[model samples]
Target: MIRFGVIGTNWITEQFIQAALESEEFALSAVYSRTEERAKDFAAKYDIPNLYTDLESMAASDQVDAVYIASPNSFHAKQTIVFLNHGKHVLCEKPIASNAAETKAMIAASQMNNVLLMEALKSTLMPNFRAVVDNLHKIGTVRRYFASYCQYSSRYDAFKQGNILNAFNPAYSNGSLMDLGIYCLYPLVTLFGKPNSVQAAGVLLSSGVDGEGSMVMSYKDMDAVIQHSKISNSYLPAEIQGENGTIVIDKINQPGSVRIHYKDGSVEDITVPQVKPSMHYEVKEFIELMKSGRVESTVNSHANSLAAMEVIDETRRQIGLVFAADLK
Candidate 1:
């Protein structure tokens, strides 16, 4: 069985551990945390066989065949390099790095070590995501796209009071774009490839972080409007309008179903039942890849991660959203 270790025992880590337990092909063996209490609690709660206080020790241990990193965006690059240098396959959480340059270095480390490295872009591995991509031709001659991910931050009240949590801290190499906009950017790049141009605008919090933003990606014949927020909720569905029909995704980040609205007034309703929660899709996909001796999933390949980063980096550039940590 493929043994897994994870860095950062946060909410997302717990969710992923549960999904790993549900899959018979893999085991959650080890975990790491910056705090002793959190690390021990997470290990016991999940019944993980081992826990480490230091990432270097975890990388050296034979306790895991691969490592899942759910650390903050700022730590993704360094933590990924540690696992890759140790000859362990790595499944890191998204924004693969703080920027394109960091991403490039991480990719080079994986290549030099001759190990598999992939971003945990769970949305790109789902049935509903594929449902939309598979019907691309049927939808025909796309004209416009709209995608948004907005949820009131659990720490927004603190943020407003001049108290900054890790999620809201720009020092953590995170913001709405890294956390939410990636959902839209992933599909946009995967389904549409690179765009001809990108223009963006956003409201920066007092902390100099993006509280919410809207970006327009211009293509030759089609345009995609993307939105992400950390302070409010979005009421609109993410959909694309083509010359022939419109494809609607209920939740672009975690889609449960899809539907097609034809120009002729006919509708096609597609159902994608959630199995082991929506996060199960990528967990299972990773297990299968390890078992089959495959390095990457064709659906969410290395190229896909690179492409998504390309859009994210450029979009940030246009908005002048520079992070100091990104400067080497």
Candidate 2:
């Protein structure tokens, strides 16, 4: 079994741990937090044996063969590099790092150490996503792709009342684009490589982070329009238009229902049922790679992460969104 150590105690981390254990290919051997008390509290729920307050000590420990990082955006690069240098495989949460430069550095560290480093982008690994890929040809000669994911943040009310949180704060490299928009961009890059150029615009909050944004990526014969927001909610389904039909995705991030509507007024459902939680698929893939002694995921390859980051970098530039990590 692959012994796994987790670096964060948030809800997403909890979901990952649950998914990992449910896969039965991994064991939760260690838990790490900045404070011993927090680590202990989180570990208690899982009955974990190892509790670490220092990342270096956790990296040096023999209890874990791999580490799952779900820390804040700004901390992803440094924390991942530390684990990589120590020869531990890392499955980092999405948006990999603050920018493409940091992603390159993280990829270099993984290569230098010959350890697995994968972005935990659950969407691409989902069975339904694979179904969408398999049925893409039904819609011939793609012309336009439109995707939108917008959910009003629960913290937005507090922010409106004059309270600043990490989700809207620039110091931690948190924003709607990084947190939600990437969900749209990753699938775009995965389905159709990087675009030739991009045009973006967004509404920045008083704290200098995007609250909602839209971007149009121009390709040779098609254009993709992506809309993401944390200040409002959108019920529109994402669609890929072609000469023959359009593929409609229920949720761009966690696609549960996917269908095609043809010009002849016929509809086809192409979704594959998922028995396990959405996060379980990524964990299974990561363990399979580790067991096979592979250092990279063909699905969530380093190149894919870098390509997506380049788009994010360009979008941020167009939107005038700058993070403190970018200055560093």
Candidate 3:
């Protein structure tokens, strides 16, 4: 079994741990939090033996052969580099790092250490996502791709009450685009590669972060539009328009249901049933790469992560969204 260490005690981290354990290829050996109490509390639920309050100690520990990092956006690069330098494989949660430059450094560290480093982008690895890609030829001559993921943040109420959480805080290197819009961008880049140019606009909160945003990525013969927000909800399904038909994706992030609407008034349901606890796919892939002695995933390759981050950097620039990490 591949021994795993987890950083962060948030809901997403909990989901990842559940998924990793469910895969049965991994054993949860360590948990790390900034505070001992928090680490103890988190580890208690999983019966995890090793609790660490220091990242360096956890990095140097023999308890873990790999780490799953779900820390805040700003901490992803530094934390991942520490683990990489210590020769631990890392499966970092996405938007790989705060910006393209940080992502490059993280990839460099992985290369220098010859350890497995994969971005935990669950969407791109889902069976249903592969189904979409495999069936792309049914819809010939693609012209436009539109995707939107806008769920009003549960923490928005707290923010409105004068509590600025990490979701809306620039110091954490987070906002609507980095948090939600990436769902759209990653898939787009995975399917079509990087676009030629990007045009973006967004609503920035007083905390110096975007609340909602839209980006239009221009390609040679097609344009992809993505809308993301943390202040509103959208029930619209994402669609890829082509001359012959349109591919409709139910959830841009999870892609539970995918269909095609053809011009001849015929419809096809093409979704491959996803594995339960969607994060499981990423964990399985991570372990497979580690066992195969590969340092990067062919699906979530370094080039793909860097391309996506470059798009995010351009989008932030267009919207005038700057994070303290960018200044540093």
By summed lDDT, which 10 consecutive residues of candidate 1 come out lowest? 270-279
- For residues 37-101, write the lDDT of model 3, one tens digit per residue: 99998889899999999889999999899999999999999999999999999999987899999
Model 1: residues with Cα > 4 Å off, grouped in runs: none
lDDT of 2 by residue, 1-328 (tens): 8999999899999999878878767889999999888999999999999999999999999999999999999999999999999999999999899999999999999999999999999999999999989999999999999999999999899999989998999998999999999999999999899999999999999999999999999999999999999999999999999999999999999999999999999999998998999999999999999999888899899989999999999999998999999998
Stretches of model 2 off by over 4 angstroms after superposition? none
Per-residue lDDT value at 223 in model 3: 97
Better of 1 and 3 by lDDT: 3
Residue 21 displacement (Å), model 2: 1.5
RMSD of 1: 1.4
Clashes of 2: 0
Q: Give per-residue CA lDDT, model 1, range 164-277, as digits (tens).
A: 998778788788888999988888887888788888888877776788898998999989999999899887789989999999898889878799999999999875666666
- Give candidate 3 regions above 4 Å deviation: none
The CA lDDT at 137 in model 2 is: 97
Backbone clashes in model 1, listed as residue pairs: none
Sorting all predicted structures by TM-score, with the top scorer first, yields 2, 3, 1
